[model samples]
Target: MEHEPLPSESHAEVRIVAATPEVARRVAAVLRRCFASTEQRSYPAGREGGTRLHLTLDTARAAEPARSWLATSESTDQDRTHADEV
Candidate 1:
C-alpha cells in the first residue's frame, strides 16, 4: 500500500493483517516491540479477509536521541580499528 506522511511528526499509521486473529496478534506484538507502536483500534476485515489492525507510532517519543551514544570519548586509543567495526 502507498504511504502518505501525516501533517505532524507526532503521529504515524500502519495497517497490519493476518489470516487469523492469533497470527494477527503475534504480528502486532512483534511490530510493537520493534517500532514502539501503540494499537489505537482494530476491526474485522471485509469478506474473505482476516483481522485488521490500526496502529500508531509516536514519533515524538522516538525522536529523542540517545545522548550516551553521542557523547565523545575522552581518551584516545593507540590501537588501530577498522571503520566497519563500529
Candidate 2:
C-alpha cells in the first residue's frame, strides 16, 4: 500500500506496515520534526480502497525550514490494538 501525505501537511505520506510500537514511536519522533502529531489508523484489508495502515502527520506548527525539507522527496523506514470489553 502507498501512503499519502496528510492534507494538513502538504501531501506527504510514508507507508510502513505491521510496525511495532517501538518503531511507531521512532517514526513519530521523525514526523514530529515536520508535524505536530502523528496518529495511527488501521483499515481492514481486502475491502474497497483495499485498506490503509498509515500515520497522519499534522503540520500545525510547521515552520519555513520544515516546509523546505518537505518539498524534497527524501525517504526512510518505519501500530495499534483495540480490545473490546476486556
Query: What TM-scores do the predictions have?
Result: 0.53, 0.39
Candidate 2: where are CA atoms >4 Å away?
1-11, 42-53, 59-61, 71-86
Most TM-score-accurate candidate? 1
Poorly placed runs, candidate 1 (over 4 Å): 1-7, 60-86
Candidate 2, poorest ten consecutive residues by summed lDDT: 77-86
lDDT of 1 by residue, 1-86 (tens): 56566736655676766777777778767656545577547778768668877788654454224223224335568666658432
**TM-score of decoy 2:** 0.39
lDDT of 2: 0.54
- Write candidate 2's Cα lDDT for 1-86 as tens digits: 56533374344554543335455556656766766545666555333334435665554456556777667746655223336311
